[model samples]
Target: MKISRWLVAVIVLMSVSMTASAEYLETKVNFSERLSSSAETLVVLVPADTQELSLSGWSNETAAQINRAMQVREFTGAAKQQLEVIAPMGLSVDRLVLVGVGTPSDLTRIEAEEIGAALANHVNSTKAATVHVDTSLVSDVAENGRISASIAHGVDLRNYRFDRFKSEPEPRPSQSYEWLVVSNSAAEAYYADLQGLANGVFLARELVNLPGSTGYPAAFAEMARAALEPLGIEVTILGPEQVRELGMGSLYGVSQGSQHKAHLLVAHWKGSDDQPIALVGKGNTFDTGGYNLKTSSASILAMTTDKAGAAAVVGTVAALAAERAPINVVAVAPLSHNLISGEAQLPGDVVTAGDGSTIEVANTDAEGRLILADGIWYAREHFNPRVIADIATLTGAKVGALGTEYSAIFSEQEDIIRTLRTAGENTSELVWQLPLGPYRNVTSSRIADRRNTGSPGAQAGALFLQHFAGDTPWVHIDMAGNALIPSASGIHPEGATGYGVRLLTEWVKIYSAE
Candidate 1:
């Protein structure tokens, strides 16, 4: 094995060369130098309802070519509509996708989310492997970052498919493409955080979309443990014995009918020891309406999604843990299913809630309020929260009144109400405050402390939950209207829409800073 000095030097140099090639420049995110730089597709966002076509990044000659193609295709830059051109002149990008923003200058976070979603849908349809977003139209890096992050979020949401039950599902095209938010300005950290938030949203959607047998109370507690406990959030799965010891009779009464034992999942993210913000949710995994059985068939079909409130809380708290939001947050998810059996609580049955408020069950179908009653009480009594926001799909009346447009929020505390409204507006998961002051008296029971439900009124549901809030600045979010998606739109796919995760996360982020 006699090697020459030149060969030995060459071998060492060759080893160094390989190592250098293996180790590429590391960054949180990578941006291309230009929009057309080695990109399979370049997307341009233009204002809708305008006669003039405005593609910001393109040159005058290139813009005229795009405009001419747009005119030929009868494209008016309408929202949700995209004009695609292949191999346009003066651009290295393979395809151009033009998405219309309703008004460019008046663009908000909601529009940005939709635009991001629109881009994802176009990419999937056109089968573009690599895509780049042109941020030239937007003025500042902050706005650009927001838009880019939103786009990342939209793509994350669109990628979700609940195909667990499909034994012979169609094979999807492998999405091996690198989705880069190519920009010259701003760091990609904000967009990266949005993707982290997306993980929480996806978790909520997964919980809500699961079959009742798989997503039942005990199963859900484990799901929360797997998702949250890893992130350093202290998760306590309270069993039937612990629930009984705490005297959560209202929750137990509604849930005992099912063979699946009830559980109260308590997730504590104690980033700060200061009085925590508490979030409570009604976790009705499935609702058979107990002794007071469901009168409508549609009600039975939608019962699996009864735990959407719990999912939202879990999602939000998990996001806070993942993002490491610098504040203490206590999330209480009370899990149960309203099923009919020999042990089922009948109408007129009375039980004391966790806060020791005796409640008369007027309709056994109003189990969400009963379960939530205990969860809210627990949050208040234990956490001693600065503010309590209790969320539930407590009433069909909310859906009837709001019609999938808004989640009806009822709060007497103007400050709490305003904070939630701001959060909703920021996330486009809108919340409209209805009356809670006058409606509170209507929920009072003659024999017991209060009735579980009142004439199926939307305001009555909030009023019923309010009894358990106990002097804490309380906001009851009746999310019945916004729980399910009729079809794919915005960041929501055609299934259980992850509603309150964004709203609560945003609210907590703002609330924590203040």
Candidate 2:
């Protein structure tokens, strides 16, 4: 389903307010200025207060000199015991919270997030309005910005509470965070990107967190179209008949089980006449596992999140448009619901796809790949894209292989793999490249066309989908590992993580130029 422009605006505003409310205080070791604007509260950072502690010289100090000094017994002793003595000076606030940054040379983005989260927790607990961070020690602009963004993203995502329907939301404690990057111009430049990324992340969270009844396939498509159309995105939605006319039998066959009609929605942003980068998503609005059926109540109930892949694509497009990224991108979503009914495609049934390739339906639970096959074929045939990437909760095998930390990427094109891997790493939505070659034991299928499932112990379903990609420079992301969160992480909340949106947007920005 599409998100409306009005709703997108509202969500963006709320996200900005929510993110701005968390106060983060950054400071140097030797700076002696006041830490808080108000006399009633102050949060401080000290070396001894945290788990690990160390120091590095900022600015004029050489890396070698800093490293050498860190090894000195006198310096080490001073650093280890520094915070304990400094804690009493800042008594203006109700509580003085101290966070330690270990060995400034080893300061990383993850460390910054840890510091930010600790500070946010303190402010949240105390109900402070503003946070004053002193960045007098940070010397690297890019590194500092990244660390700051990570901290803000983490705090914002964790603090997200979907209390829209509650009447008492106003009484809940909320804190606003502002970072004072004294000498970092790069941090200022990256602030806009951070804001946009936060907006996209929040959009994905809201979309996935909504109940299935309110977020049906048609409604999702409408919302997306409304959000993009005003920004000059060309939007089109093909109904079941239209899909049938285009011979999308695989997608059509899957939708037969559901009461909601299927939709193949496409949104295009042609910033230039360059070869488009195709983004496809498996938009299973809801899945009851069709004819095979789901035995576990948890699995069946969690089917509401099946459309997370589609939501990511929609969020990507919205963000690209919002940022005015100069790239040609086309997003295709094959939306449907898999339910049990007499009309549902049974096991062993073969359906021809848009490319006229027959797929043997081995298991209805593996239906995500079927619809995505249609989308990939459609994108290839219609747009002749230079690179094609399809995102989906295609398999639990991915989660088993990569766990919940990263998305599994399967691709035959090394360059596309490299591009995606770099983008994923930069955004912290990491992708671990999985083998896509035909393994002799799992490659042989006895039934029609190809088997969706490989051997019993086969752990690479993302690679399995590569068989249907034809000659396209395609990458399949098994978002099963990253799409929905049992809990919040980074900038994603308890629902949809919006795993691929930022990576895809960044990749496209680099792709179009090439």
Candidate 3:
């Protein structure tokens, strides 16, 4: 057989291009005391209130060019604002990026992170293989390398991209980063802790961003076990038979229509002897709305991210365990798929949750609460924990109520509410408290103890789950709109935000300290 030279060349190019997007961007971060001037790219942090650029050591021509560029761009050094001078004459570095840190006194750890993320986004577009960031000018200095570590963590977070399944005309070539920063060993140690958090967030985002065909209930459970068990956490997965035997008919009903069986993944991390904090997540891998099928194209397309809450719970466990936090925590995720089949539960079907509370399936679209009903009940019954927090992408009303800026939080406990708000602020995964009392009676049903859904938006879903939470200090986080972003942001690209993992992990840290 004879082949033309053009055909062989095409084959080689096709093979290389096909495998280009298989790997993710790998970055190696290093910290040192000295700032290197001879580099491919150099990033300098400038405070907003500063009147002059720090060009004391630079050459006369290079400094003039930088000043001219800054003036033309009108760079005021506002927080996260950037001005780039490429290939300045007489300078060893190829690219010089002046990043604004706002006011020296007002710069915060969160702002530092945003700066890092913005920088990562800036560099991700270009082919800057090695970059150097000078953070010595930032006035905010604290122990455990808070500022530097935060910036490093932000860079790692924004560097993530989930384009694994895009095999069309070949995805973008993977870019590796070698991040060199001016700092000490303290920053390195602190970033190790933050690295744990970044790992968990990546895992959560990957899980949620996964397609429904590969992310079914049992597969999701196995992935969770693979991620958590090696970190010294106890991972237990209950199949459909075990779930049915445990009186989790409400959860079982949601999966009856799908070929994939429902699963209950319980992950426990014992860092201390104190009472554990139970996290229950609604793990609906794909919600087709069951008998009441989703009519909207957009709604059906976004159903794959319905497992964001479960992914967050699993990620939180990974984060805590990896960091070796001094807190006892247990994660309970009810995994299922709400698909249409002959055996699917219909409207008005009544099923018993794990806590013996009967629920009427008023709307098959409201399946997240059904699974959480069993999950929350299982967490409370078995662990008898100090507090129970349930997170889910449960309702569309939450999007209408709070929009995408914040997740809706519902709880009667003032202390828990305050703690959650603080954690949200710390992590930038903001939460707004909604009235829990008004929706308590909305889930009333004539046939069963309560209906799956009711009027007044997200609160009703929370109330139905509350029946299973019982008297435990519980907080229901309705992360409907916040789980997935419509477009790429500074911190996260356009996809699953991995919303609750950082919030829950920060909350655990603060609560355990108290």
Could you report the Cα RMSD, in angstroms, for every candidate shown? 10.4, 6.8, 6.4
Off by over 4 Å in 2: 1-91, 98-114, 139-150, 165-173, 183-186, 230-232, 440-448, 456-464, 489-492, 509-514
Give the per-residue lDDT of model 1 (tens digit) for 7-86: 34433432232222111111112444353346677776555665665554457878788888878877776655678888
Q: Model 1: which residue pairs collide?
A: none
Name the regions of candidate 1 deviating beyond 4 angstroms. Answer: 1-31, 34-39, 45-64, 70-81, 89-94, 100-106, 136-139, 172-187
Which wins on lDDT, candidate 1 or candidate 3? 3
Q: Give the Cα-based TM-score of candidate 1 against the true structure.
A: 0.86
lDDT of 3 by residue, 1-514 (tens): 2334543443343223212212233666767766543557888877776666655468878877887888888888888889999897777777899988777566676788888888888877777777777766664445225667777788877877776666663434233433334447677778888887877887788789878867888878877776677778899999999999999999999999998879999999999999999999889999999888899999899998999999999999988988899899999999998998889889989998887878899999999999999999999999999999999998889999888889899999988999999999988889999988755589999999999878886878988888788889899999997888888787787898888999999998887787
lDDT of each: 0.75, 0.65, 0.82
> Candidate 2 on 1-514: residue-level lDDT in tens?
3556655664454434423422111211111222334433433333321323223322333333333433442333222221111122313344433334554445555455555555555555565565544443444555555555555655654555555555775343355455555334555555556555555555555666666665667766766675567657799999888999999998888889777767898999887787888999888888888888898998877887788888788778766766667788999999887877888889888888888767778887888888888888889989999888898877777778788778887777888888887787666678888776556456345766665556532233554556556787888888785767676444443566667777787777766665
Every model's TM-score? 0.86, 0.78, 0.91
Q: How many residue pairs clash in each candidate?
A: 0, 22, 0
